[model samples]
Target chain A: MNIDSIKNGYVIDHITAGQAMNIYHFLNLDAMDCPIAIIKNASSKRMGKKDIIKIDIETDINLDILGFIDKDLTINVIKNGERIKKYNPELPATVKNIIKCKNPRCITSTEQELDHIFKLTDKKNNVYRCLYCEAKAGK
Target chain B: MRHLIDITDLSVEELDELLDLASDIAENPKKYQESCKHKKLASLFFEPSTRTRLSFEAAMFDLGGNVLTVSDANSSSASKGESVADTAKTVSCYADIIAMRHPKEGAPFVASKNASIPVINAGDGGHNHPTQTLTDLLTIKREKGRLDNLTVGFCGDLKFGRTVHSLIDALSRYTNIKFVLISPEELKLPSYVKKDVLAANNLEYVQTADLEEVIPQLDILYMTRVQRERFFNEEDYLRLKDSYILTPEKLKKAKEDLAILHPLPRVNEISVAIDEDPRACYFKQVLNGKFVRMALILTLLKEAGTL
Candidate 1:
């Protein structure tokens, strides 16, 4: 597999195996008009099996979106044909439209215009509750 | 502008002010008879609520204010598919304040976001009824004479009872307040509430299925009905409906001065025989609801500069 290295882009690595597609869809990678490569079940020393995504364009990505999906994933920033920085995304204080409230009584269910918002109520348990109904976010 | 969407919207100081104002209203009704003269309140109830709707109307009437009511969703512009925001904007034109009740949670919040006037959440599905919490607080303060240093036992449907949740949130702010949550296993209080409100506040709480064992230790017994409307399955509702009946037998072991409170329209969770007991404060709670609501309307209107 001869995947070309990106000149100026992002290389999202260390994704748990079989989660690359979810990140791709959540990040709307397919909608972008740029060269992208998703390597699934890639061999790794630290992680037994990992998924990697390479974006050819230096586009800004929302780390919060990635962090909410899985905080353990590594985010690598590339510039001038070299790796510039690498870090992990922290749990966001709040998320909007990332996950919809499944509670039928929630306002977001009836009012389509309302944003599906969830706030991190429990940091230790990584629990998120709906802003309106306070129902725990579904896993 | 201020709105009463949640009990936590009011600080302990503000809550105390409301409580004090409510006490004053109870003591001297004539003093506040003309406080809201010429001011109008719009009652928009999209669901059937006999107590809350009447309480708001009675509160407005008590203040010598006229009321504009939309008692049913089918009779309102909502049936014509008007959005809550549009309705709120339209109502803001005719009223000094808006008290809205919707079957969907957070409808009043949306109204507050769009309305020019302050919006009070009368009752929103199984979510929040802030005024009810105020009623319960005033009842507790009047009965026990203090909000803190008391063992409060919440009996029956804790899961779907918004009053239970709101009252717990309100009481968690006071010091030395312990909770004895008595409910069936399937209808126990939600863990997020326990974690965020109880445990986070460093409040001691015990969860149990038996209410009788913990009855004697409680200073206040907050009874809640197993609401049929909140249950999707009839079987589940039927199974839990009679989980805890506060009969005369159950009260034998309870404290002599235990304040028994219920947010009413109760469906036999409390026996009618208990109505004659000295400790039964539910009816008094209903009357306190009107006074507290009057205080709330006055406070919001005053803060919004409508007064």
Candidate 2:
């Protein structure tokens, strides 16, 4: 487990154990040309066990996807091999084309071209519902 | 300043205000007759709904405003592949307010996003019918003389009936509102509604197939048509269609003051003999629908600073 530290890149840290693969697939990290390493089940003092993704090059990441998948995830910006910034992404007020609304009668289900959008209606309950049919999102 | 996309869009205070305005309009119709004198309403109904469309037109007419209508998609540019946003923008130029019904669940929402004028959703697919919810609230308040502390029995199609869902969501906010959801197993209320609206709010509700068991306990009995269009199989529709018809004998145990309401154009779910019963208030509900629409139109126009 001797993963090299990146000089200038992003380290998506503190992902819930076993969620690294989901985050990887959701962000399409496989298609990137940069070097990436996923360390799963790394021991942590706060989280107990976590997964971390280390990218070798600095690039733009879709924070919305990160927030939607795991709101508690922290992104560590590594510059000159030093952790420059560590911040957790905020849950988006609204997300478009991320998770498909599963309601059969939803317009998005029938209309292929329409964007699948969900709005965060209950922040305290952490509930996101389909904008069209009002069906709770993520089923 | 926003559209009435869902019943939830209006706060409880706003809902109470609308009901108050509706009651005032009901009491003195002549006073609000010229409220929208120089304004106009555009009814762009991409779906065929006689009651909702006509009610909106009647509301605007009673308010001394004119109406511009495109009753169906085939009669408008929509048949030629025009998008809802484009049509809404185009209609905004001709009307001060827009009331639209469409087969797509979010078509009215799209219109509200694009149009400069205020947009009211008449009925959007099986998604929402906010005005019908408003009508139900007005009826309950007018009949029972209060909005809270009532047992409501919602019968027939709870699954596909947008009116039932909307009314339930609206009533869940009031105090001591209990719901008796009566429907066949196949047409039971959706789980999300049961969880998000009822359980989330801690509102007391019970699901039952026996309407008779709950009829006697209800302060308001809201009947909805078990729509054949919602069923995948014609045989299934036929089997469940007559399962909960409100006959006089069934109403024998009902409270004398129970208000029977149906967002009309009802089929066989309600017997015509029940029409003579003093409890049958669906006709009065229809009239209240018009007055509520008038109140809504005035409220939206005033919010937009047009009235």
- The fraction of reference interface contacts (C-alpha pairs within 8 A across chains A and B) present in each candidate is 0.76, 0.62
Candidate 2's error at A132, in angstroms? Answer: 3.4
Per-residue lDDT of model 1, residues B1-307, tens digit only? 7899988889999999999999999999999999999999999999998899999999999999999999999999999988898999999999999999999988898899899999999988888899999999999998888899999999988987878988999999999998999998778999978977998889999999988899999999999886678677899878777658899998999989999999887779999999999999999999999999999999999999989
Top candidate when judged by TM-score against the true structure: 1
Could you tell me how far off, in angstroms, the CA of residue B211 lies in candidate 1 after the best superposition? 3.1
lDDT of 1 by residue, A11-101 (tens): 9999999999998987888899999999999999999999999998866766677877888999889998989899998888888887799
TM for candidate 2 is 0.87
DockQ for all candidate structures vs. native:
0.70, 0.53
Per-residue lDDT tens digits for candidate 2, residues A1-139, read 7999899889999999999998888778889999999999999999999999998887666656687788899998888899999999888898888789887767676557678889998877778888877778872
Model 2 clash pairs are none
Considering the two chains of model 1, state its CAPRI-style docking category. medium
Report the lDDT of model 2 for residue B93: 87
lDDT of each: 0.91, 0.89
